[model samples]
Target: MMLAELVTTADRVGATSSRLDKTDALAELLARADPSELPALMGLLLASPRQGRLGVGWRGLTALDITHADDPLLSVGDVDAVLDVLAATSGSGSAAARTGILVDLAARATASEWDFLVRAMLGELRTGALSGVLLDAIARASDRPAAVVRRAAMLSGDLGETARIALTGTAEDLESVGLQVGRPVLPMLAATAATTTAALEITGEASVEYKLDGARIQVHRQGDDVGVYTRSLADITHRVPELVEVVRALPVNDVILDGETLSLDEDGGPRPFQETMSRFGAEVSRDLVLRPWFFDVLHVDGRDLLDEPLSVRLAELERVAGDWRMPGLVTADPEAAERLSRDALAAGHEGVVVKAIDAPYAAGRRGKSWVKVKPVLTFDLVVLGAEWGSGRRRGWLSNLHLGARDPEGEFGDPGGFVMVGKTFKGLTDELLKWQTEHFPEHESHRTASTVFLRPEIVVEIAIDGVQRSPRYPGGLALRFARVKGYRDDKSPGEADTIQALRALLRG
Candidate 1:
């Protein structure tokens, strides 16, 4: 299929706000894609080539500028040539050369051209669609059930595998499917509750571990080699070399451990989350010291412990990890656990994750199975209309408007929907500039600089406290509430329901 056709469909999807329209367009586009092309297609759809965590990227800028310049320095052919050069040079030359080519491309292109290219490169054609939507499209195009495609994709972590299976015209159920290495698995997450008392009750256990504030990690080791992956399954072995050594030093040869990676102060206490993140780039060698705290073991000597109970896994972890085990495993009574949780909070940690001793390793599942209890933090919300961001944040008009979800769903419906907060925090400066520019495009109404966006973005905010309010929607207001990035990739529809807010307030 010509790239233009895909581009046109993406354009249509972006212009239309309806989910059905977006899905239909994406499906049509997926229909024309070759099975082998799925990754490249995903890359295009996600605009992976151009997305930067910080802002509108140089390649995206180049693509936009070159496409519509009055006296263009580079032609479409030249742009393609540059991409070819980039692809070829990506792994070769110094990082400098790679950056130079992209910079040159952007310098030669126009701002409008850069904008289009940016969207294309980020594959963020926000037409209210998601990976699930794309899976449905692939299924329809191949004349297969969406479930089959989804299962294949989930099991293989590769859409190409699903497409290939679909092309074979074979009907297969995923439950019977086996695991394939390199396939992506969704990360398991914990649900949040307003209080430790409530969270403990939900789990039917008086005992729970305070969820530690650190980066979640999954460690896979074979013999002397170790690989560390984030909750997102991105291989970050290079970033956390200390973890590699820690895992290598383990008594067991072949093992897979799941845990958190934390930065430690000279005194052995946990450092800030930012300090842990700083360990990712080259600066890590100079700045931060990292440590791995094992929580569970998944594979031991080629045996998969996923089916085993957490009690068994924890035992295996303790036996094999020995000295490398995470600290503070002493059994605590309910009251003690609460005190420990409070201590964690007082020490500036996020909160505590409480776990049941007998729970199985439910890979990629989230529920009260593991509950996180944190102090309630509120924010005065401002309703900002949402616009698309890059990669996984492409569609669904994300980044959020921060009005407190009304408990009563009445009052200014302040209980209903009153806008009182807005922020571009927790984002890099690049993201800030992008949001500032794009915020206007989606504006429903405007005050001088702050656009009164359609109430779409529902940010999951974390704050220090809530207080009485007179100017906001709810009679209550948030104190020092700020964006905690976007919630574990939830849709607006799946946001914390009004009922949840009511329960929280009542508690």
Candidate 2:
């Protein structure tokens, strides 16, 4: 297929607001795609290259000198071949090598094709379609159930390859895809609940496992060979040799264990999250020792247990993981759930995940099958600024710049506020309209992307916790901050103090 065809379809997809419309457009395009080129085409449609990060980011792309072509002539094969060359280039001379390849492609591609390619490479294509929508489109094009395709894609962790198989192969072929010991399947996610009572009401009898504020690790093992992957599926097997040793000692020969790992202090309590994140990011000799706590077992000794219920999976996990298992209990009562939550907190854990006892693992997506209960701290924070939204939220002032009051000027000017973090979560269209209409009245300054507001609007913000940060003046930032509501009753003076937030850090 011509690259322009995909580029034009992406433009159309971006222009539409309806998900069904996006799915329909993608399905139409996929229906016309050649079987031989389906994998590459699927990758482009998803705005991520099959090549994976090609060594050139937005900086490298912006530095190149380009001669834009007037005509569209690049084919799927042509672009994929160029990506191959770009991916092959490495070492000290790789930058210039990548620039040369991109310049040549730019010279041969039309303006629209160049735009699409740039967006795809930078991971900024606002095509209004990604895994979920594109998965539906693949299902629609192949005349298969979306569930079947979703399962295959989630199991494989490669949507492009999953689409290729679903479109080109039969029902039996799609069914043949299952849990592999080495490849990382998407980790099952949990939804948030307001209270333990609400979570228990939703899940009935459940296993309320202690939720750790640490890095997520999915361990895949076959005999002695083990690979540890992050939540995003980046293999970090070599980064933690101690962790590999722990997994290697597990009784089962072939296993995939889903768990969390955190560096522990001398008291055996978890260190501050930044310490763990720093260790997760760096591949170096470690100061703090990271302890692994297994919560779920997706596979054991060549037996795939992903489709098994939580009760069954827990039994399998107990048989293999032993004492390394995450601490939890089985109960339907909310008070017991609350007591377990308190026990977790008392034991120096963040919170607890309340999971449905009968629920099977749903990978790569958030669903109501599992609910996480945590103490939510809310504060009346001053609105510092906001940036323009995108796609469905386009034209609205979204992603608010939040601030905590610094009345004593510990970190800044007296009576001023400190910029903590930004959030666009829990916003409705009504709230978006209100912000667009209301924030302009208090606008102190403006930028290409942000409308800086005078510190007058007191908005209530909810957050899981605070993290030590160097980015903001307060030396602290809100973790998982979200909008609760605008606090019309509060003043800037009454807003939450930086000292108060920093205190949360000490706790």
TM, every model = 0.68, 0.76
Q: lDDT for model 1, please.
A: 0.58
Pairs of residues clashing in candidate 2: none
Instruction: Give the alpha carbon lDDT tens digit for every residue of 1-507 in model 2.
Output: 899999989888877766788889999998888877887887777666888659886556766677788888899879988998898899898888888899999889987898799877755565657577889999999999899999999999988778888989999999899999999997897776667888888888999889886778999999899999987677888888889999999888999999999998888888865577666667675877788999999988878887799999999999899999999999998888899899888878768899999999888766787987778766669999999999999899999999987645565454468999889998889899999988886676899999998777888888988899898878888989998777543446557778767866854
Q: Candidate 2, which segments miss by more than 4 Å at Cα?
A: 377-507
What range of 10 consecutive residues in model 2 has the weakest lDDT sum? 407-416
Q: For residues 1-507, write the lDDT of model 1, one tens digit per residue.
A: 544455567668666655566667877776666655555555456544321232334333333323344443543334555665666664345466756676776666655444545555543334444455567777777777776677566545555456556654456543344343333354556776766666666665533554555777878777777787776566778888788888888888788787887787877677766567666544346457778778777778877676677678878988988766654443336676678778877766667777666676666556666777777543224345543455755433344456544322354321135444444446555545655665554455654333555444445567655555565555555556566543332333334433334344433
Clashes of each: 33, 0
Prediction RMSDs, each to the true structure: 8.5, 12.2
TM-score of 2: 0.76
**lDDT at 88, model 1:** 63
